[model samples]
Target: MPTQVIQAQPSTNAFSGFIQFWKDVKAVAQPYWYPNDSGDRAFSDVIRSWGMLFLLVLLIIALVSANLFNSFITRYLLDIIIEEKNPSKFSDTLVLFGLALVLVTLLSGFSKLLRKKIALDWYQWLNNKILSKYLNSRAYYKINFQSNIDNPDQRLSQEIEPIASNALSLSANLLEKILEMAGFLIILWSISQSVALILVTYTVIGNLIAVFLTQELNKINREELEAKADYTYCLTHLRTHAESVAFFRGEKQESNIIDRRFSNLIKNAKRKIDWEKNNEIFNRGYQAVIQIFPYIVFGPLQIKGEIDFGEISQASICCYFFANALGDLINEFGNSGRFSSYVERLSEFSDALKSVTKQPENVSTIKTVEENHLAFESVTLQTPNYEQVIVENLSLSVQPGEGLLIVGPSGRGKSSLLRAIAGLWNAGTGRLVRPPLEEVLFLPQRPYIILGTLREQLLYPNTNRQITDAELKDFLQQVNLQNLLSRVDGFDTEVPWENILSVGEQQRLAFARLLVTRPSFTILDEATSALDLKNEGSLYQQLQETKTTFISVGHRESLFDYHQWVLELSQDSSWQLVTVQDYRNKNTSITKTTGNTQLKIDSFLKDKFQTKLENSIGEGLSHKEMNALTSYSLSTIRSKASKGESITTNDGFIYRYNKDPKVLKWVMD
Candidate 1:
């Protein structure tokens, strides 16, 4: 027996498809036409205020009337030339024809000018409204950081103008087409109802086919946008990390990554082009058929003497324009596809902005209040994803005229705690009582070097101050950045400060800004890490001289001298707070007791091994130093010492050289 064959049937529900297509179009268009805010409704506002709607209606009426009059004159002239053959009437007909032509041309030019003006006005208004909303809600940060939305910058900068301009232009064109179709339908039906019926049927069928062909275009367009954004992001990443890539000599690796992104973009673009090409081919064939169909229907009438040459010409013109007007969907399928994609992007971005600005319901946020002291009450901190807890029910406080230094191992939420204090991260429940925002200043480790003049840098986050040149220079001198002005050609000169200034210099400049502002509370998250001991001590001394109370996050023991209290964060989401003096006293006792034991161990090692103990241990002495000496953790060191794989002195320090004589020989050699 032969194998049975089955072929899939195409969807025959053209009516339902047509309805869905219209519904999709309406969904894209409704937001701009009828906006949530009356002020932002560009179309309605512009039409009402600019009198453009009235002008448009009048222009359409005049244009249609003039075309009818022109048609009438052509028919009359033909009748006279063919039937009456009067030369005198021919001159009169020519003059009437010239005048009608002139009137129509003037009306058409004026209408186009008016339409352009209205479209431009609407574009400007809508662009401003959308831009304001985007910036006001700080959606740029949310979209860039939190949301998966792609190419917000492109949507705002590139897509908005075209969306606004095309929306108004398409609406006007559609309205004009409607009027033209209505006016010409009468002429075609009077000539022959068969021509009118043929035109309508042809338009309906062509539009249905176009809609079906372009049904998946919106999905393809969105993919194209994503591919473009991906390629753009790749380029931006390369630019941002250019220095690192250059140092690593990884140009080939970066090139491969960029090539992959470009390849993906090309694939999507080719797919879009293929679909567009197919749509265009169909539209071109449809247009060719429209051109010849009228002549085929009306030629018989002219030959039979039922109509004159003028009647045939008028009927063809009327039928063609009427059919063209009704076949808008077929002609504008490509544009509609792109327009729908643009609408979806813009609407999604707008909604994302709204979502970012609105506070999440039923989620507990850190409640901040103004007070003289900076305190965290019953604070519980977690990652933004809530995957791990950082600080659990911790309470700490730092009063005026005091500084609190927060110390923790890496990944113990030291920076996150600072972010919580700065109000940037609000992932867990807490009551953080602190001074008002204006009264507090935060300086992160990597100082944000904005693009501006040196003066602007000093006055950042408060640009409307009345500080004199002398005062600004004094503050710069205090932070030891007095030479910055001379290097950058004084305060008013602008340069790329991030590139021009070293990291340490930028950090000091940040301190200079803090000194200038002199807020009641200052939070520093390893802000002095880039500075040497001298500069760091000087900056902290200046802070002490000022009225600004500060909370610092650092690992250096020197930081304890400047801070009044110490808050040490542990790995188990617990923290211990102690007075800085008490912590220093405890450490001092331990150090004194450990110092004698270390001396005894050093003497014994030197006497027995004939090696300099200082050279073996190197410069620094701490848990880190011990790890470097033993290549193991404190727990590993303790375990190995118990098993004689390492040796521990009375100071609780491990030496790997005792168990492995080869290690000591290698070090001494």
Candidate 2:
């Protein structure tokens, strides 16, 4: 068969892309202008509560008045110097000029101070608002785990400050320039209409060219930001996985990865610099032309005596200020591009937070009740992707003070079922009835070692509760962690607990927390995987002593002694539930054979005792199987044969079992 090639559609032209970019910019800015509940209150609150509008009006008035007064003084000084012809009049002119200069300076300084204060206030308010939403809504988790939004940490930590500061500064400066332009345009037009016309035409054309030249600047900035974030993420990843990398001696590999990320960052940064450089060239030329163009236009009139030296000088000053103010868009084009990029990122982050925080409408949630029971009714469990059904139509319940053990092969959704019961996973149609969130606690295999003092670690997830040192000490003793107090310099000492404590020690500490809190219900997902049998038995005994109910997902046969019931999950979303004793009886039944044949019952026994064999597989055989297979005593053989398979021939009966030779020999001895 001939191969067929498919081509991608061509990209949009610059004009269409530019239009789309502006549309996106407007969409990002719309929330700031017309905010909803999810939007930050800082912008609206600052404008309303801080008298920002009033301040802005005052600032504009002060700036325009100051510039007008300065222009008047310039004209007055020139006129007096040229026509005075008297030393006494010159001294008076000098004194008047000094007073006007001081007044203009004061007004300008006061206006600048007000602008700075407003900007600072907005910065602080917006930062607090963004942080409040980011944390209070739990957007951090959604962004990190559930959403495709990148670098929320950077967006929240780094981008927010600049957004607040630059947005305010740019808006204030732009407003002031507009006011200044209005004041100067009047002065320039009065001096010479031709100069004013030329100034307006030049500024308009220059800004138009700048807009087209820097149209792609925002896209470049966004790419640069992403590259920088990627590089930072790589460095952070290396630090987080430092132990794994060290064990594998992957320093060179990690360095190569870092170098690749840095290279990408540098490439994007170079593009940004080059774009800005080209932009700066255009702005600088436009600025230089604004300076000299007025003189060139009016120099002929000055030489012809139609306009005096003072008139030319005054026109030049007014024309320069007016043209510069009009050219604000051209001069600050790069900053505007950067600001737009910041706004786009922050706006997207805000939108993501809003979407994540908003409760899904018309979606069923695992309804939690105030009762002391956990129940699942016709629950169908599936992965988050909904690609595979893990458990189907499963119904079970555990009352207060009763324990349930969930057992299944690996990847059989054992842990996912626990998550659903805990209200973390809700991808399928199911009704889960559990105690209120506050009354339940979940302890996974690897206990979470929070960064804090030992006392704080015990009191975590419940930090506000006040407990005496004696009570904390007693709880530590209950979990066999009393030595932790002295080893870590008492409860108040702060250390990196995850690094300082062994995994077994951490698991014990987590159990200590359980004892201290005494939650109404607890869910343990292999929570005892790090502890030995003795320690595990002690912890379970402690739980049995309490009125707290728990459901455990484990593969330890010893755990069977603690749980009253077993919930076995099988393939094809099938499951079975039976009392612990009944399950043991079914698996321990013996099969008798009458013919002269070798019976193979390992496959059947393996399925029944797989959970126990996983941890107790001594040299590829279970401890019980080793003893039964190697025993020489007829009594032991009969007892072991009762729980396994046997064959009887015409001459005699033969017994055989699978186990390790060493353990079998030891049992025989």
Candidate 3:
């Protein structure tokens, strides 16, 4: 299989392209991301985990109470040491404080462990659902066709995990934060009345900055996905034509292409880095301000006997609660930005698929043909780019058990006509009355070679439409492709046949396939062009024996003999359909006797130009006249002239010529 080299086509316009891309993504994600069944499940899981969240709340209360109790115990111990206060009471208080701290730490660990388990389960469930949706309804092919969006391969591969993973983790973290806020807010508010207000204000300020920075990062992430897909597309395209690149020595140029795409990616990444850096700077300063401000407001009160040391500790615990709640807000904001973008991308993919699958108006799928012959009633086909009709109002018919050689100059719609009949091309007018579609087989110029062994190639299209291996091998031998059997590892060998065999070999294999399938009529569109003359002759001979009616499109003059009728498409876009008998006249230039004495020379010229001669002679001649003319033999004419006379001249002896040439030669002599 020789690869055809093609330079990169123009980049689809960025603005228009991205708009469509975004639209497709939006369509895909809309139903999934909307608070529907899956969203409900996600919501339920977050709710279900609230039992552990409540336990976490209790753990926070215990930890805060234990610290306050420990502070009191410390003061009692100081009194005992300095003022001879009761030692037994002090020792008992210290023991209680240590036990409470241990119990609270264990409870918090258990809460964290339970929340983690629930988060992961939800993530897996949601991701599988998204994957299933993406796979259904031929969405993949429709997406590929309808949009210029790059690398759906990445959308399926990379984007999905992050979408599900981050979503689940963020949701779980927010839930825990809400519970933490509940546990701490009351205690902190009771302990430090006005200081609690300052904690809330600072938390709001810090989180707002984090949220804004994260939103910017989310934008960068979306752009990164697009950039990565673009880079992947180039690499895949390069792989598809690796041989062409090697032949053209384009490694350096391709490297530059890859490098330029990556550089754009790097710039986006740098912007994300800068945003994160600024965000961290604000976060650290805000965190320092919150940590010290809580202590500073409570410290003076405790010193002035306005509040106990235990009360100051409780205020610090309350600050932790409010901070945790604000953290949830920041976490939700970050994930909301990213998840929204994912939703947008997936939605666009789904919408484009829906639009594409809406079959064109008036496009009929010919399910069953109820006739003996296929007829194209004044069919006209137009090229998409050219907007010019390749075939116009061309009515043609092929009856059962009869054949036609569709002859035309290159690019004159011979193959296009077949494609229209096959129902692959829709830009055509006129009803093609087809007998059951299964009855017609079209072997294109370059036949498709699926990845399989020789046996699989023959058995394709009949996938499990069981045919014996022996019979398939026999068909292969008939097409002179028996050599393939030895080359193959075995009948079931799984190799890429398109790469393994040459195009000519593949066409021959297509013939083998045809023999097994044995449709009522076959159309060969230059199917034999790559084969040498002998194989072409043999294959056509096989078709004749099989009595398989065929419509062949080719410029090879040799095919004219195999077909009984030729339909030559004219430059004026008219069709001249004629039988072989119409080309039988013997007086045309093609029929003029040559003076080449060599046997091979005469045989070769006659074989090569015989069809042209027949056609030239038949153009204006009646079928009966043309037949009567070929029926007049050179042997019979020579025999009759020998019987009459030979007149000798200085140059040579002459037999009967035309009446005019005879008299004039005699007068000159």
Candidate 4:
């Protein structure tokens, strides 16, 4: 069977980056709210952890009520002592009230400590839940590339801590206020009916004002969040690419751009800060006026013989509770606005992520097609920025063990075609029958190398695949990279793979990976562009020996000879699969791998290397000899050299020796 090529029409990706991120957060949070779910379980675990505080609330309430009763007795005894001169009774009453005060103070202190302890644990639980989701879902990648979720690191690390702490404290405070209002409102109503009416009016008016204030605060907060994200993004971007700027000598240019971004952020942030400062000023004044309100309303009534001492004391407690509850309204309302904005942002982000792929109604199981054979019928592909087709479906066939090269001017969707085949670019309509995705390897122009040891670089995506340490070293030698093997400890050694390897070295590493994994087919999209001609030709020649089906996208003319056929993308929105009859003529003497002149080939390569440095021994090694050295079977030459042993091939190629001229020539060269 032959490989088929189809020209595809592009489709736009409509998913909003911000909306998708919110969806992911909700998908993570919703199940936690479920009673038996892990999230719910974690929340429940919080209750147990704070059980002491929960119990203390009951004790605190009892102590407070008892202390309020003692206040009534103390007030009555003082009145009797002043009016009737009953000194002994007043003294005993004073002693009893003092005892009640001591006990109440002790319990209140203990409960406050317990509350603090519980609050810390709740904060930790919420933090863990949010951070876990960010780390696990490859959400970091989605946030960076697919979503407009600006500065997720800031969102997770800084924004989350405040959200969690404030949410828990506000919830607990609200519950306590509700209990106080319920218990005391009834007592105040009985003692001073007129005052109760006034209290209710004040409560209603205060809450309305607080609600209005909070709505305005939300507008300010939303702007603040956006500005903060922008500032954080600039800082993070600056730090991440600091090394790049330093290496390129472009620090001033980068610094100026960052300064502009920061200035914009600061301009917006000042507005938020001014709004917050004004609101807080008003809130503090309102809170101060509310503090002494209890004494003002009920004191005159008690003096005029309107109510008994017990009734007066009860009215005072109720008035205080009512006034404080009104004050609480402002704080809770402000917090609710902040929380709502966060939720809305989260919800919108989720919506976008869910729409990443038009939920496949029935995803057909993908199968790996046989070598050099691809079948795509009615294929179309699209990108977000363009309405035109990236590629439109048409057909061509390629036989097994054959190479098909794609060449075109830039932005022709040559690389995109490979991505679509890999299932990374899903914004397309097509029946793309490919070999099992795992059976093929796609190497991009700049391959991503994760931070890890050399072995890790080689065994990527198949980390658990059984590969020996010795096998890894041999692979490195085949790519003429034996020097790196010593610096690396093992496959598990952690290092920044991208920084340690040069662009060309990284491509060679990718090729080294090809030899180890041995996929049935390989796609190279400017994979060798970073390498010089010699290394590039060497990589292609190595690919030839494996008889692996090759689909390449490059403008390099040297690559044309390796393939039996070439697929040229045309400006007319079509492709040409032309057979090259003159392929043999294009082949250079150096590239011809096997011939009767094997020894002659070695001498020729030796001569080529001599021209670079006259003092160098065996400077030019023939391409065939180089190929023989890189092949898997003769990899022992590298291991032998590392072990300080003299070794040579029977075909007159001495790999590691100092004494013999031929051996010294191979070693020094």
Local accuracy of candidate 3 as per-residue lDDT tens digits, 1-669? 111112223238977755654564444433434445564446655565555546645655555555445444554555455456577866776677677667767756765675565445544655565555556655554445445556667666666666545554565556656656655665566665576676777787778877777777777888988888898889898998999999999999999998999898888888878877887887677767766776788788767877666556556555755675677657776666556556555554444545544555554332323576878776766642225567677677777667788877887878877766675554656667776667878798999877666666777776777777787778888999888878877677888787778889988989888888888889899999999767887788778777777899987656765788887776666777788446423223244444554223355545543443345322322222222233323432333233332322212323232234323211111
**Which of 1 and 4 is the better model by TM-score?**
1
Mind giving the per-residue lDDT tens digits that candidate 2 earns over 1-669?
Answer: 111112122237967646655664565544444466555455656357457657766766876787777787777777778865577877887788788788878877877777676656655665676677788655665455445677778787788777666766677777778788888888888887877887888778887887677667768867987899899999999988999999999999999999999999999989889998988888788778887776787778878877766677777788778767766645565576567667667666766676666656655444444566889888887654456788998888898899999998998999998878765667677678888878888899999988888888999789777999999999989888888877778888999998778899999999998988889999999999888766887899899998789999998776876899999999778999999977765554432233555545587675754433344333343344443333223333433433343422212324334444454411111
Estimated TM-score for each candidate? 0.73, 0.75, 0.61, 0.62
RMSD of 1: 10.3
Over 4 Å off, model 2: 1-50, 82-155, 158-163, 212-223, 263-284, 298-306, 331-367, 381-388, 426-431, 449-452, 477-505, 532-534, 585-669
Model 1 residue runs over 4 Å out of place are: 1-163, 212-227, 256-284, 330-366, 381-389, 425-430, 468-474, 477-502, 584-669
* lDDT for each residue of candidate 4 in 119-225, tens digit (9 for 90 to 100): 56545655666555555544444444444565566565555555444544566567666666666676677666777788878767766776787777677666767
Better of 2 and 3 by lDDT: 2
lDDT of 4 at 373: 66
Candidate lDDT scores, in order, read 0.74, 0.73, 0.63, 0.63
Among these predictions, the greatest lDDT belongs to 1
Q: How accurate is candidate 4 locally (lDDT)?
A: 0.63
Model number with the top TM-score: 2
RMSD of each: 10.3, 8.6, 12.6, 11.1
- Which candidate, 3 or 4, would have the higher lDDT against the true structure? 3
